[model samples]
Target: MAPDYTLDRNDELLIAVSLFEYSREWEIAEPWNAERAWFLCRVICERHGLSPSEAVLELE
Candidate 1:
């Protein structure tokens, strides 16, 4: 099933920034999209058994 959370532009940017800091792969890419950030967020949430909001908090 898909995640129950919806991220706004600020949340998407926050996720993108976190991804950039946490992953060299994303760093090399530089610019990140909401789609990619959302996908990554879902992956993280699923891997850690967290909700999307919790994942963002944890990432922060």
Candidate 2:
């Protein structure tokens, strides 16, 4: 089922910034750290009731 809850502006901004940092780390960090960053990004999306794709759409 879809989540009924919605993020407020501050939460959205926080998530967006976190996502961006995670993505950056995924690109530039060592392989192990990159993997960790990727995992964290997924966790963040899941915790917020979003799929990675959905999170991207929300950022747009």
Candidate 3:
């Protein structure tokens, strides 16, 4: 089930910025875009209470 939650704008922005920085650091350290993408997708899904597939759809 999808989450009933909606992050405030501030929280959303913070998560986005943190994810950006984490993604950059992960790429620099490991250069694994595919793995990073999946990891990020999972994190986003978990945070928002969506399944990975659902999260991907909503993201698109």
Candidate 4:
């Protein structure tokens, strides 16, 4: 289940950015680099109908 396109792009981008920042900060603060990280971020973006393309996916 995911959100529809009813929401504005700005709103979606904000959510995407928040999740992206949190992911980066957490990954930096801690040391956990696995596929799970990408999965979680993907879930977050999908739930909010925010495209992950806006996120800097550098989880390696």
Name the top lDDT candidate.
Answer: 2
For candidate 4, report its TM-score: 0.39
lDDT at 5, model 2: 90
Residue pairs clashing in model 3 are none
lDDT-sorted candidate list, best first: 2, 1, 3, 4
lDDT of each residue in 1-60, candidate 3, tens digit only? 997987874454355445545666677566687457557655765777765555434544
On residues 1-60, what C-alpha lDDT tens digit does candidate 4 reach at each position?
887667564555555566655666677565465334556667767775555774434221
Tens-digit lDDT track of model 2 for 1-60: 987998785476467557656666667656666666667767777777876677777766
| Reference-based TM-score, model 3 | 0.40
- Alpha-carbon runs more than 4 Å astray in model 4: 1-6, 28-60
lDDT-superior candidate, 1 or 4: 1
| Alpha-carbon runs more than 4 Å astray in model 3 | 1-5, 30-60
Quote the positional error of residue 47 for candidate 1 in Å.
0.2
Candidate 1, residues 1-60: lDDT per residue as tens digits? Answer: 997998765566466446534554544454455446556766655665666666556555
Instruction: Give the TM-scores of the predictions, in the order they appear.
Output: 0.38, 0.53, 0.40, 0.39
Q: lDDT of each model, Cα atoms only?
A: 0.58, 0.68, 0.58, 0.57
